[model samples]
Target: MPTLTALSPEILAKYQPVIGLEVHVQLLTESKAFCGCVNKYGGEPNTHTCPTCLGLPGALPVLNRKAVEFAVLAAKAIHCEIRETSIFARKNYFYPDNPKGYQISQFDKPIAEGGWLEVPTAEGGTKRIGVTRLHMEEDAGKSVHDGFMDSVNRTYIDLNRCGTPLVEIVSEPDLRTADEVFEYLTKLKEILLYTGVSDCNMEEGSLRCDANVSVMLKGAKEYGTKAEVKNVNSFRYIRSAVEYEIERQIGVIEDGGRVVQESRLWNQGEGRTYSMRSKEQAHDYRYFPEPDLPPLVVGAEWQAEILKDLPELPEARRARMEAEYGITPQDAMTFTATRAFADQFEAAAKKAKSPRRVAALLTSEITMRVRAAGIEMEASPVSMDGLVLAADLAESGELSSKMLKQLLDTAFANGEDFLAVYEREKPQQISDTGAIEAMIDEVIAANPKQVEQYKGGKKTVAAFFVGQVMKASKGQANPAVLNQLVAAKLDQA
Candidate 1:
């Protein structure tokens, strides 16, 4: 390829990037998918392995019922069509992490297929992203390349993760931008969390994503050669990798060169994707049905039983919250980041005079303080009841904004609840018109120059008087009353 340069706006706008994400979410089952060993993330290397997971001769594999239930629950939550009968196929491969020469996974007939998620767009609208399939499979072991004195020349394999149950969610080539990719992943993760199937923790290898990127001419029917970018640890890095890969493929075609299909690694440090191997060199897997296990049957009765109590999904909850609370779309999103948090917010909103006020205090005040304290929202000194109290007080004009801030600060600093701090301080708003007018009079007499400026059509000077009076009253004056009193006093003067 010729030396790459930044493309002009016209050239950049001539092509559209198509991105698909493959997300692997480990199930939170108590045992391995096909074994009796404990299913967990960290353990002594190789200690969690057994004959079945290790693929020992004549060691039969038995499926875990809990894994199937979890997988079905997740699939239903995403609106996938659950198959009545799915077969387990042996995906043959040879790698150090693969204790078995082949992986037992669903091939032609996966557990579920044909789902869609409504992804929020930058234009304040939503677009449906198609889910190609959600299939159940076992996970491979970890390959540790560091943390040893001789790690520079050695590799370590930990089989604890081997045979752990997983569901790989593959998205259709529908994402057009990096932001859409992010929104799709976020929505998917949120749905999964709401279903309580998986934790979706990217840091602990419980969740992982691989992005396939390709670009095509604006009106082209066929997509350009696609490259799979792997080893991206977080959603932010995945977005960056997809962007870099799209540009690279575009650059190749613009340089009179054909884009090559290959697997690449995302180098976060360098902010680029580098080739790992060509698609031609990739393994065939030689998939075939597993002879040991019979066809897994999830009949309609069982499917209904599994999904009968399905929790309301994230999107549905967000929409309902927005309508019920009369809160903004942005606040709805924040409140529904987690199912538990959403429940807590709703409970408080129901008791408070204004649900919008509760939402405001949460996103604007409590969220910032909780994050700054490096604590979880559940651990915040402000409980849901406390939040309700604060919201009610603010709505009733019993607490001024400044007074509220002071009380919140003291609560956070003293490690006490908001109600405790409020009761101790007993801060009251001065809504008495006469008292506020008296303070305004003093401020007006003290600053004749500003008073003259106010009367001389410099109407903006009224703000100075309001500030002076507010300061003199120590922020106790009700803001609404003070503003009205100041304007009236200014007009009279």
Candidate 2:
């Protein structure tokens, strides 16, 4: 086998890569999907298992109503059509962590089907990617491979994640490029997070993605064999893995070789993917309806009740916030990155004198300070009430830009809210025009050379006088009033 190098643009453009993603999102339920065992992450091994999850004889499986509601909410977020009835099947598989020997999942009939997400394309357009289905299922336990006696040779099974409620979202083969896949997954994750169905913490495994990638001639009607890429922990790495897979497949075909269907693991350390095992087909799982559990039903009435809990999604909320608050699209995106953040901004903006000022403070001052401190926005020293006060002062000209920045710096430095620092510092701006004119007169007398330059068609030199006057006022000069006074005084000089 020849070593694979980067393919040229012409060779790459000759083939189209078809990508489909399967995302498994763990719901924020209190208990396991079929049992009453706690569904929290990170506990002692096998401590969260029950008879049903452990697959003990005579143990019967029970459906969790909350999980169903959450699954339906997630499905609706992606615009899927909710089915009246869906069946749970026994997907037979053998693994060290799957104590049940057969995993219970939805097959044939799923809870929802046929949805689409409109993602931004690289060409500055939106493309709709179809979602094949969103089905309810349970997660298998984890197998820890190291950090124990004989760690390298022996594997440890932890069933803490066993039977956790999950909703698997499968996307259609509509992605043509790695960038498209990244955009699609990003939009999907945003929608899921906004719905509050799952935390979508890729590191904690609350959300996981497996991508199926294949490449064929641009005009070919049939798709080439696809290799499923798994174990990619982040969206960025997923994009890289798909890129490498596309090129590798193309390279093989260019060398008169065929692409094989297999399961591959992305080695983030090596920046490439390696074959894991042969890909399993639907028949390999031998899925059959579970004898213990009956068909799950989510009627229209139940769905309507669940729909009430669905908050405004990201895209719609971003547009509405942009219009209502007169914020830029970028600011709207920043504010609405999470529902809680958007709610906080809206509540504060309503009370503030100027919503735009509030937007400016959030995107510039507060965000920068919070990031610098390496703390979450919620943990910022400045609260929403504090923001309202600051914005009000700035809008009413009670606080100049310099004053606000200094006050914000003081607040962050002292670990206090903006109101506390403002009240303590009592830094009042020199808005009195008579006083400003007096200072401007002093600045003009001192900078006679610059003053002459200002009068000699060098009007831009007026900034020198403004700076001198602001210094004379000890950085307390009202910028708007100071600018007017300085320009008028310089022209007179």
Candidate 3:
């Protein structure tokens, strides 16, 4: 086992790690890529298979129109140029899970090409990672090995996942570090979700990543032999794997051994990349045009139709949210992390008169509640309309800041909307001048020492009086009114 070490800055400055990620995103479509079988996850083994997906004797394949649309939408989401004509080829490989003996995928002609995903860097700027191509393919089924380790036993094959639509996004070798690769994946997943194309769930195998990593001497034009790391289900694990690979390759070169091009699996338990097999070149697969399917021709009209439905991507939406809601970049990024979050925030923010305050509350209070409850933003019990009402009540002196927070707490605790909880609680703010004056009077009488301190040039002690009055009124006291009342009462004392 290779022990993980912190590479010193001096060591890091001597070599460069060139990284690129090939991410496979399973499109969320109603049907499979080439068959009418349900494109879904988690069913009995081989239950979702069909003759076409199983490669029967005479079952011809037909392409799914929706899958193509989703591929185009995904490609456009990443700023890729849509190719007018693309070809589906047979990626020939032998695997028990592949019933067809080949995967229907695109080769020289892909669906889209030449796009870039801008990842936010730690230096408060963006680095654009080039996307080489985005192509469509069918996913293979999974092999469930049932026998114990080091024993001969039968292996079960589940074809439920076969023929599922997938869009493989290939990126240029522009990522220089594991952190860069992580940022690129994060931003790419966000864009994919925004377009409503892929769920990007790593656990269900809907989203997967294979990273090609190599280390070269600083300022060297020639590249090092790259190792492909797979079986990384999460972004963090992939980053760790890449970091370990870079270090291992550098160590090998240091010991006068050349790096080898190979495919490796990420040992998440051991935190290392172990070789699986020698990486195969393009010719090894012996690719050929998929005869059953015709050339996929996306015309101008089709492009217009698909482009019209493409949602506002992450970059443009982030900028618009910052400008429209008057929120800071951090707030904008948090609110627009996903399409659902952005939609919910925008809906509530637009309705509230104080958009900035609404943005703050959502990013702070609302997001915290949603995360703690383990519910998605769009599925929050507090609806956008309910949030708007809360914001309105807070801004118009109907509820104090503390009261507003209390109301949201009640809403979240009871798993009810703001209106529902507010109606039941009917919490009122003590904005009445005479009522507030009486409370302030009682507080001043109770805290005479603090009062005397305030009168003796301790102006800061006014906040003490405000807290007492707020406590007396059970936090429903209007903060602004209570503050004024406390200052006036202390000034007189």
Candidate 4:
């Protein structure tokens, strides 16, 4: 086992961290990858399994057509070049959950390879992370250890997840910091969700990650002994595990010790990684072709059909929004992060005559209201027309920015018509310049000393007079108009 320690300043200054990630995403298929069993989570133990999933003798496997189509669509969406023909190979292993004594997965010839995902960095820059390969595999069942004098003393297994279709996206060691990793994961999840490939519900174990972390000299070309952190299900854990592992490895090397190559598990509750087992090599899996299933040949026409069905990905949408709407890159990125959010934003923008105002409101006022209400953008009661109406009201001076925020909150909560709400609220406005003039005259007569101060070149006292006039008019006096009126009145006083 490797000893865990903190990195010294010397090591931190001299070395740069290298990181790669292997993400396992369970496909949203109706059935198992190779069997007709239900591919659902959280059910009675073993209730969703069939003879094939249970690996009974003489039982054969059949590939689910929808699963393959989804895999190809995912591959194309990520900019990967799909192999015209891909084969399935058996990876032999001994585990209670893997009843077949071997797992069907892609080895030498995977379904997709050589792709890239662009992630946004904290400094408002973008980094292109290279995808090494994307392959298909079946998930193993979960091992539950519970119900004992001590929970650690007893162990149980649930085979419901066995044979579930999964796509493993392998990335190169291009990430240098934890922030980069976070951005990459977020962007990847957005793409996956937009494509309808996976639900990406981390709480239900639908998506998981294994991080490969190591430390090398800052400008060196070679790598270091890397530790594979396994079973990290949440983004917070992924970040913490990588940071901790980087410090641990650097400390060991600085103290005249060598880091070992091994696999570890992240204890999210404790916020650390513990040794799980030694890292296995390719030979350890005993890779061979599965006799039950034949090779999969994706013809050109099939690939073309999947490509035609692919919608505009996040990058394309972001670029289009930036170009067409003249919004900032960051705002465009935010708007296009989700399909539904992007669609709603576009719909609202179309209804709004002022694109700049629409963009600003969506990113600021609307976003703040949505966050305060604890609801998603798509679920907000404020419709596209409602937003357009709010923008128009603000543009027409019917509402100030402050009043617009209040109006948006009311609209979101009650889903009432904005015009009707405005009429009912009827916020006082300084529409009558004559009324404002009378109020100004009253203030001038009441505050003769302030008027004298203004005439003596004490310009700051003019604001006080304006406030008095506004107070007399119940905050309905237009401050701008009152300012001009007060200046003119004081000039002759």
Candidate 5:
């Protein structure tokens, strides 16, 4: 086993960390990638499979047009250069889950390449990670193992996910830290969700990531031995796996041990990587063209049509929202993280008449209330129109910040309109100076000591007088009007 040493500034200055990522995003098509069987997961064992996906003899594979279009859209969103023509090749391998003894995937000519995605760093800056290639492939069946039987082992196979369309996006080694990996995944997931290409939900296994991590002498010209961490399902796991692997490699070098090139599985429970098997080089897979399926030819007209349907992506939306709404970049990023959230924000802003105010409310008060109610932005009872009404009341001086919060709570809980609830509550404001003056006189006459204290230069006692007058009015008095009346009466004294 190889041991690593902690690199000091002197050693660090001679080394660099090179990282590359392979992301598998399952497309949201209605059918399988190469067959007409429904492309679903978690069904009964072998229920979703057909002759083609099962690799039965004489069963032929057919391409899904929608899947192809989705791949094209995804490539365009990432700013990849789409080729006028691309081909699919058969990657031959033997495994229990691979019934066909081969997997159909892109080998030489992939769909997209040479793209760039900008990720944020912990230091409040952005790093652009270059994308090397984006290719499509078919998924394999899942295998289930049971140890209940002592004598005979039980093994079950589910083919529901088999033949499902997948796009494997390979990135160049541009990331330097664990934070960069997290940011890259975050930005990538956001774009995929916004484009409607995939749900990108890791919990459901719709999206997955594999990282190639290696470290070398700080300024070394060549790279060190690399380890591939497979199937990191969550963002937290990605960070942990990468950090652990970096340290592990460094320890190997420090102890003068050679780091083996192999594939490792992330044992989340143990918080370490365990060796799975030796990693295979490209030639080991023995790639060859599939005689069954013809080359995929994407013409200029088809690519152009898909390009026209692409919507405004997250980065552009964030920039526009920050510039136009006068919100901070962080706030703008939050608002536009999801398409539905961005749409809701814009609609509410138009009605609220104050984009900045609406942004603040959504990001803070409304968000807190919604989370407490166990609702997401899409399912929240507070609609854009309802928020607009609340903003209107606050802007017109009809409600204070405190009152507005109350109104929002009630509105979100019962789906009641803001004005209707305000009417029922009938929170009153002291608009009449005469009425306010009368209330102030009664308080002053009742509390002579406090009144004398105010006259003797204790200005802080003004708040006490305001509280008394507000309390006497049952807390319905308008604070602005009460302040004016209190000041005028004090001046006379």
Candidate 6:
């Protein structure tokens, strides 16, 4: 490709980029897809393999029923239409990690299809990203090429991951920008996590993405030549890779060069993509139905069983939380970051006297402290009831703002439960009317210049009186009532 300069926004706007993502999620099954080998990660190399997974002679593959259920649950979570019947096909490829010579995957018929996820757009609205298909397949093992003592270029094959079940979700070519793509992935992952179908841990290779990117003139009817970006694990890296590929393709076309259709690997260290090989078409795989496996059937009874206990999806759950808790849409979104977290919050809110105030405390203070300590909401040091108690104190004017901060900090530092700390030794907020009035009177007698400033129509000087009263009261006076009394007294002065 020829070198090209960066175009201005006006010039860049003349071209459009089309993007799509194919995500692979490893199911949380107890064993391999075709055999009884343990499906867990991080075992001795080749220890989790079996005759079926190793492609040995006289071995027959059997479908894992748990894998099917996971696939069905995931499909339903994405609002997909389940197929009545689907067949597995062989995807032929040569690699050290693939001992079976071909991967057993879905071809003409997949488990489900015709789903859509609504992703948030930059305009504060949402755009629908069409889900093409969700299909189940077997995973290949890993080839470890590093950690060789003698530098003779030897690679070690670990069959521990072979035959692990995976479901690949392919999306339509509907994405126009990297931001939209990021939003779509985030929502998709959120749905997947909500369903508990997969762990979606990119660090462990349980979740991965392949991005298809193309660029064309803004008004062009046909798309530009597309490239497949393979093996990007992180969402941020996926966004960055798609963006770089789009601009590179546009640059190539503008500089009188042809963009080739190929497979590229994202180099995270260098922040660029390099060609790996030519992108293969379906015919190149020469796919055919698996000989050992029969066409899988999904009947109405099975569908009903799966749907009967299906959990409410993210959007629906978020709406319900908003309606029931009387929280804003944004607060609902924060609370619904995870299903368990939302459930915990709702349970706590139900017991609180001031539910809205409890929600506020959770979203603002509790969530922040939990995240700052590198822990999840479920793992926080504070109990839900304890948090509610603290919120109740604040809402009822029994705990001042400074007291709440000190409570949270002390609770966090000591790894003490908030309620235990509150019940043991809480702040003595001075809510007594006469007591506060006496303190205010003493402050007024001490600060004559501030009182004069207040009487001279500089009404903002009432803040000075409140501060003096707060100081005189040793930070125990209710700030809200003090402000009110100070304002009323200054009006009289």
lDDT string for model 4 (273-304, tens) is 88888764434787877777788888999988
Per-residue CA lDDT of candidate 3, range 242-356, in tens?
A: 9889988887876678888999999989878888988655448889999999999999999999889899887798898888888998888888877877887888887898998
Compute the lDDT of residue 43 as modeled in candidate 2: 81
Clashing pairs in model 3, backbone N/Cα/C closer than 3 A: none
Candidate 1, 1-493: lDDT as tens digits: 5333576667778899999989999998999999999988787899999999988899999999989999999998888999999999999999999978899999999999999998878888989999999999999999988656764667889988999999999999999999899888888888888888889989999999999899999999898888999999888998888877877888899889898889999999988889998995666999999999999999989888888768988778889988888999888888888889888889999999999999889998998999999998889998899989999999999999999999999999999999898888889999999999899999988999998998899999988988999899999999999999989988888
Write the number of the candidate with greater lDDT, choosing between 4 and 6.
6
Which whole-number lDDT from 0 to 100 does residue 389 have in model 3? Answer: 86
Assess candidate 1 and give its TM-score to the true structure: 0.87
Tell me the tens digit of each residue's lDDT in model 2 across 234-338: 999999999999999999998899888899999999988999998645348889999988888788899999999999998999999888889999999888888
TM-score of each: 0.87, 0.95, 0.91, 0.86, 0.91, 0.92
Per-residue accuracy of model 6 over 32-69 as CA lDDT, tens digit each? 99999998989778988889999999999999998998
lDDT of each: 0.90, 0.91, 0.89, 0.84, 0.84, 0.88
Clashes of 6: 0
Compared with the true structure, model 3 gives a TM-score of 0.91
Candidate 2 lDDT (Cα, whole model)?
A: 0.91
Worst 10 residues of 2 by lDDT: 146-155
Write down the worst ten-residue block by lDDT for model 6: 1-10
**TM-score of candidate 6 versus the correct structure, residues matched by position:** 0.92
Highest TM-score among the candidates is held by which one? 2
RMSD of 6: 2.5
Candidate 1 whole-model C-alpha lDDT, 0 to 1? 0.90
**Candidate 6, which segments miss by more than 4 Å at Cα?**
7-11, 147-151, 280-283, 367-379, 487-493
